[model samples]
Target: MVESILGYSPVLRHCFRNVSGKQFPRFQVIKAQAMELAKEPGLCKEKERYRDSLVGLKPGSWPPKNRADNPSLYNPLARQERMGCGWLGAIFEWEGVLKEDHPDLEKQSWLALAEEEGRSPPPGFVVKRIACMKNEQAISEVLCWSRDSSQLKRMALRKEDIHQALQGGVYRFRDGSREFVNVLTRHKIPVALVSTRPRKNLEEAIGAIGIEGVFSVVVTGDDVYRGKPDPEMFVYAAQLLQFIPERCIVFGNSNLTIEAAHDAKMKCVAVASKHPVYELTAADLVVRRLDELSVVDLKNLADIELTEFGSTPELEMDVEEEEDDRRPPSSAAIGDGFW
Candidate 1:
């Protein structure tokens, strides 16, 4: 209603000025201010002379009754003083990003499962392929195990048991992980954790690590039908965090994680824990430790704006130019990007 009289762009720009240099404002603040500004005369002849239903209501009493027909006026990007400056969420991977799993433990678990089932041992490549997959998903999809739900459940539970025995029930944080988590919490950014591990095991591990209340959302294998390389877990995490998929930054340590994050339309920061820096070229940013990054780095990663075509306008233009020139464009054509 307010936008109909005073142009939307102009009114929201005014709201941005009023809320500048502070955290993003609630929709009510912008709506209330826009409605108040619309009431003054000389603003495009007061179209319809029909004030917003919200006008003249007490400041404390918001959301006039019977607003079923009213359209939503909230725009997350518009509320930002700048791109990525508003409320953003963080999603973290469990094994490689936050805690370091022992070398060969993953492969050993698969081998043990195969032996218990009287099957051939899985190769190293197979282990890596299923690194981010839930046990049942990997067993049925990659390993050609029986798809019966009861058998899948029994096999998945046994695999976790073998993994637990190999892991010795120990948990350890990666270098600088705990401190970085604390910094995000102190800055009021919501954090989420995603993993293919069972929720009961993950929650127990988190409790043992002494960071019980740190993560605002936790997504585990039990919560999803599939795992990484599918984007289901990351998407669910963003939904629970109440942030748009584009507003979430995923912290992970493998190419699989990077693939899943990009599939979910989220920015990814690859932690080069096991992989070398050159191998993680697909990530938006690569760092050796979590503390090496600050909030500014996260904001920069999420600063990208997408066109209706689902990619940045500059990228879209480059693709058009590539088609016009009948050749692949140089990497620098997009940006002087390291990845």
Candidate 2:
């Protein structure tokens, strides 16, 4: 019995690790719930109106009820003030009214709503609060974007042209890429790039590398409802690749990108393209260069293994994997003369 438990110690460690983290399961669950509520078909107009009202209004003059019915009497400037600087009480009360009046929102997931907003769900909701324990580490991650490859930088192509070029022989192969793409192709696991740059830049960069065919998907900010740190972009990438967020591995150097991956429930590898390894402490795994990592280095992140009684394996993998993958490759090994 002792050996059995000891053998499964890593799974226990994984749970404890998440529990010890500041955001843990609560924030994740809530955000998901809120998105569910937002997708209600009947509540579309009400949600849109609520969002509009909050978008440009100031702090002190928010509407207490639906402004559409009594537009003539509504104080637009005062409303703006309220939105800009309203106390939490006022904001909560008004938002409550907005939700209450929206018939579509009547059946919406309140627990999800509260969680996305990082607040407690109101009374009458079914969600049990994921309690915040003391001394939890803050959940933060990076959202990095690589600089445009040299060819794209020189051409200054338009976004549409970039996308068009990507499908054909538009991009040409050159330096710096042999290391990143060659190794991944050798392993048979598809490698994709997620970027916040314009489509044109991405297309040119891919073409320059001459390995555009290697990727199963390339997700950019234009394809998402929101940019990095919001989770939409990463989620879209996972969908396009026919991969679950948990099964995906992200390589990035930005705080926003890292946070976005974390929010999507994906494992992230931080690459030190522009920043030093020490600055990338928030990443789950930090790599100084891309060459040091291979397919086997990411085994722990392949899938979520469940224990018999219900537990996930601890992420006992060493930080060395992260360190190795982050380093730029040697020139002769991968053909990346740019490095």
Candidate 3:
């Protein structure tokens, strides 16, 4: 009410006075009601709904197991704890774990692509950063190349062509890769091959390497949109093998593979192919060669030792009070700097 108008009417002034203040009982009650309603889950600002959207299957996919409709492969044993190759799977990486890896060829491929596309050549660290990424993913995400699907496809193909022409069509297994694969086969363990290579290229390489029938399942870059350090490849490989990630072991050659495998809820054995064994300490087990591992080793790795609290707790102390360097490598350290 205006002061001049309120002076003329005392009753009207008294009623309208202090109406904008929160001293009223009804105003306090309304404030309390709003505070209570804000506590509702939908109104909560902090809590996130990541579990249902991330766990098990993708958003709209069906349940992984349909035991009622589909017959199960391995019958459940009556033991308290199960142990055997009957249900375990071995997932191997192609370029490094099975066949020897040549980091030079990889770097060279990128350099050749850069030269052909008139882009600046990626430095050594940049090359290392994208070592585990698929060609198109590296082109778009890391190298800042054209995001157009057609251009990415063309450049990725051209890079592969350069790599193939430089490396030739030869496929040689690393020192003990064949022996380790045979051991798994003899034990009747299903083997899976996962790689960033395209399906056709990987199939041709397997054929050339004389191990066309070895892999029970092969997951290539074509099967997934992204590559390491995303867990999609390993997770999808586990699914294709009809085995839980816990029952599968991933054998890879770098910290990226170890990170991806762990994210997929699988144990990983890092092979010291292009990387040194000491540098791969993040893996469940690091071996100079695949043959260095035995059936018992794999079994122990597959059966993760969990604590009463569900997860294995980190130790309060480091190895003999030494610096803790066993942490996994991070790809994010490369930032968004262009090559």
Q: Look at candidate 3 and tell me the lDDT of residue 228.
A: 97
Give residue 326's lDDT in candidate 2 (0 to 100).
59
lDDT of each: 0.78, 0.45, 0.76
Stretches of candidate 2 off by over 4 Å are 1-177, 307-339
Q: Write the per-residue lDDT of candidate 2 for residues 8-65, one digit (tens) a residue.
A: 2222233212445654433334345445654574356444556755676777654334
Tens digits of per-residue lDDT, candidate 3, 200-282, equal: 88888888889878889999988899999999999998889877788889999899999999999888999888888789999
Instruction: Please tell me which predicted candidate would have the highest lDDT against the true structure.
Output: 1
Model 1: per-residue Cα lDDT over 18-37, one tens digit each: 43576443344545754665
Task: Output the worst ten-in-a-row residue range by lDDT, candidate 3.
Answer: 1-10
Which is superior by lDDT, 1 or 2?
Answer: 1
RMSD of each: 15.9, 31.0, 21.2
RMSD of 3: 21.2
Give the candidate order by descending lDDT.
Answer: 1, 3, 2
C-alpha lDDT of candidate 3 relative to the true structure = 0.76
